[model samples]
Target: MTTVSVNLPATHYDVLIDRGLLDSVGSLVAKQWSPRKIALVSDDNVAPLYQERVAASLAAAGFDVHRYVFPAGEASKSLTVLAELVRQMAADTFNRDDSVIALGGGVTGDLAGLLAATYMRGLHFIQIPTSLLSQVDSSVGGKTAVDLDNIKNIIGAFYEPDLVIVDPNTLGTMTQRDLVEGYGEIVKTAALEGGEFWQLIETIDSPAELISNAPELSARSIHYKASVVMADETESGTRQLLNFGHTIGHAVEALANGALRHGEAVSIGTVAIMRVFEDAGLAEKGITSKLRDRFAAVGLPVTDPLLNSPQVLDKVKNDKKNRHGHLNLVYLTAIGHPEIKSIPSSEIASFLNLSVTN
Candidate 1:
């Protein structure tokens, strides 16, 4: 088992990663906080696979486990679903002494964590992220939210989990597209952490090879994320570096209307931003091409033909990263180094138009 500790001013927690860690989650949770009632939240897609095993484990550990399963997908992360969960917890007479366990992908973690953070003035929260995206990123960070008004994660809070158990074996059931989506985030993390890490990623040519090295890759990505979150827990400073591909990524994702996966959209967003930087002489020559080639090699999309530049620009106008109508974009002078620059929203729109034309 590989264990990484995230030490923060408010609380410190451990992220345990290994195959079959799911079966031992109950003992792990018991060590931290002995809850009389535990709410295990999962989605329909994931429930059939491991819900019983998780519930049985916790039941054996002497906790009253209540299973709450929602429909799978990003659509499930909403105010309505959150309200239902809150009502259910209330009906069960759950108190602050109870806990909530998120046992699925990013959506499950976000929704369940948000529920735990807000319910009963904040109950204990635990994460058992089953997806690669959640395992390496969302599962570690305290950022939790749900989609509202067609905007992604516009309504959310910073609520850390008491413990995070990541089992790589959960990823074996992921589809090819899901795995590719995860690689998009992994590639983005490697670019941010550059040097040896980037070199190591460059050597991995295929999705199969990447999955084969999931344990090392996930730990490295989580370590970088944990270090950044520790320095800036609230995303007021260095943590913004992690938004390398998300500014435009989120916008395009909304425009696609569920056609684009988060990681796939981010892959295209990374390439799009690099192209804009290259045009303005802000990034090194051939850097965009190199990134495009790398994304392609990993079966990630570098550009979406269905995306319209103007429509995407309209969506970016509402992105959370914008401050006072100015776009704050994270750009790379090269891999491993990211810079946040403020540009007029109009200028960003023009750049998106130019990227489409070129």
Candidate 2:
């Protein structure tokens, strides 16, 4: 069992990672809060798989478990769903003392976390991230939100979880595409983390090899992100480094409209931004090519036609990173080093129009 502590100013918590950890979640959560009403929030797809096991564990530990399962997909992350979940809890007579436990992938975690943060002002929140993307990235960060008008995470808040329980065993049932979806975020994060973390990912020659190392890789990714969150909890400073591929990635994701998974869009986004830097001579040549080779080896997309669409540029202008008419773009000088550059929102068209040789 590996435990990563996220020691922030206002909230301190532990991210426990281990196979078969799901069975022990009730006891683990009991250490944080006394047995109470637990709103076990899960998506329809995941509810049938492991929800019963989780709910049983919590029930056995003396907590009243209420199951709230919604349709599973990116489209489910919206105000309509959030309202429905919130209203359901209200109907059940829930209050501040109750809790919210997100029990699925990124979409589930993001939506449920927001439900916990906003319900009755705030409630004790717990995360049982099932997907690789959720387990490694979204599950740890306090960043939570729902999409608005095609903008990703446009409405959200920084609400840290009281406890995060990660069970890599849940990943065994994921489809290959779902597994690769996570590698996109892993690659982007490892690129920013650099050093030993980057080297560990580089050694993975295929999707099989990637999954084989998921337990250790997930721990390292969370550890790196926890440090960043502690330093810049509200993204006022260095935490923006975590947005490496997200600038263009979010735009691509919005344009793809569910055709691309979040991490897949991020995979293409990373290549596009690096190409812009390489073209400007701000980064060394061949770096973009290296990314292409590595990303392709793991079944990640390196480029997409929508990247050149005017609609994508329109989406870029609305990204959350934009401030005072400029948006911050994250690029790598090398595998282990990332730097942020702010560019005028007006100039994003040219960057999007630039050819990204995949």
The lDDT values for all models are: 0.87, 0.88
Model 2 ranges with Cα > 4 A deviation: 351-353
Backbone clashes in candidate 1 total 0
lDDT, candidate 1, 145-251, per-residue tens: 99996878988999999899989888888998887788788888888889888888888888888678888888999999999999999988889889988877887
Candidate 2: clashing pairs of residues? 194-336
Worst 10 residues of 1 by lDDT: 349-358
Q: Put down candidate 2 lDDT per residue, 108-193, tens digits, no spaces.
A: 99999999999999999999999999999999979899988777788999999999999988888999899889988888888888
Report the poorest 10 consecutive residues by lDDT, candidate 2. Answer: 349-358
Residue 159: error of model 2 in Å? 0.3
Residue 44 in model 1: lDDT: 96
Which sections of candidate 1 miss by over 4 Å?
351-353
Q: Going through the candidates in order, what is the number of backbone clashes in each?
A: 0, 1
After TM-score superposition, the amount by which residue 296's alpha carbon in candidate 1 deviates from its true location, in angstroms, is 1.6
The TM-score, computed over Cα atoms with residue i paired to residue i, of candidate 2 is: 0.97
The Cα RMSD of model 2 versus the native structure comes to 1.3
